[model samples]
Target: MACAGLVGCASVAVTDDAITQRTAFALGVDRKDLTISNRVDDGTTSRYQVKTRAGRQYNCFVGGSISVLGRTVSEAICTEVGRDGATRPAVAPANCNALLKSAGKC
Candidate 1:
């Protein structure tokens, strides 16, 4: 019994003034760079970036800490869906059905 719907994701920050936003993994990593991914100004410290193939991206965010599994795995959400259609706007990574489901953005 999986709920078919878009997983609504939000942003999380490590500090109060820190402008760290989380983009879904599906649309974030684009081998080159994340276009639609949120970023801070020049003075601000925004080094959150990941390298992955297009279409495989989904429900991932820029965490302030390093990913333990080498790949930045976003287990920060709790949900499920039947399909995946969301993207992070960066590398246009391939979408994952399971990620979209768990991320609540399908």
Candidate 2:
């Protein structure tokens, strides 16, 4: 049972890493420059608070399932952080929205 719990944790870590990478790419920033400050996981879905090197922050959501074959696939939704640290998806610029749309995110 302990081993099974460890495996589950490992899988969640992998999923978080994948989502972080995808978010960095969508934001056109280096992966290393982004910091994940907070995360919440609810079964197959997860949400994150990512801060960029420039101090800009975002709220990111990722959801998907792992297949029996151990393959993981997920979709991500991200929005800029407002002055009060709230997620402001409507404030996203056209170019950013286009990029997110192309990546099947947002």
Candidate 3:
């Protein structure tokens, strides 16, 4: 019973549309240009692989939250994946710091 309560309190179902929109904004591309796949969910956070029409691939992390008041998406961040499998922030250097700071990652 206690575990169930905890799970309910901590879980939020992040919608595909939300993820697509967030990824598009982060990658500076149109939502229609992106294809999302390989979703892995853990608690309130979900990770997905995004492939763009231009053959670029990205890893996107989306966090969601549910409270007594309502449900909301906490954050979304996408990073480009190199051919060598390295992940780098997709945002330009000029905006990278700001983006990371806003995401509470820096």
Q: Which candidate tops lDDT?
A: 3
Clashing pairs in 2: none
lDDT per residue as tens, model 1, 9-99: 1222233222222333333332244323333312212333332344232232233322333323232221221135534332213554676
- For model 3, the superposed segments whose C-alpha errors exceed 4 Å read 1-12, 94-106
TM-score of 1: 0.22
Whole-model Cα lDDT per candidate? 0.30, 0.66, 0.74
- By TM-score, rank the candidates, best first: 3, 2, 1
Candidate 2 structure quality by residue, lDDT tens digits, 25-99? 767789899898677776656778889899988887776554445646454567887898555662345555676
The C-alpha TM-scores of every prediction are 0.22, 0.66, 0.75
Global fold similarity of model 3 (TM-score) = 0.75
Predicted candidate 1, C-alpha RMSD: 13.6
Model 2: lDDT of residue 86 = 57
RMSD of each: 13.6, 5.2, 3.9
Clashing pairs in 3: none
Candidates 2 and 3, the one with greater TM-score:
3
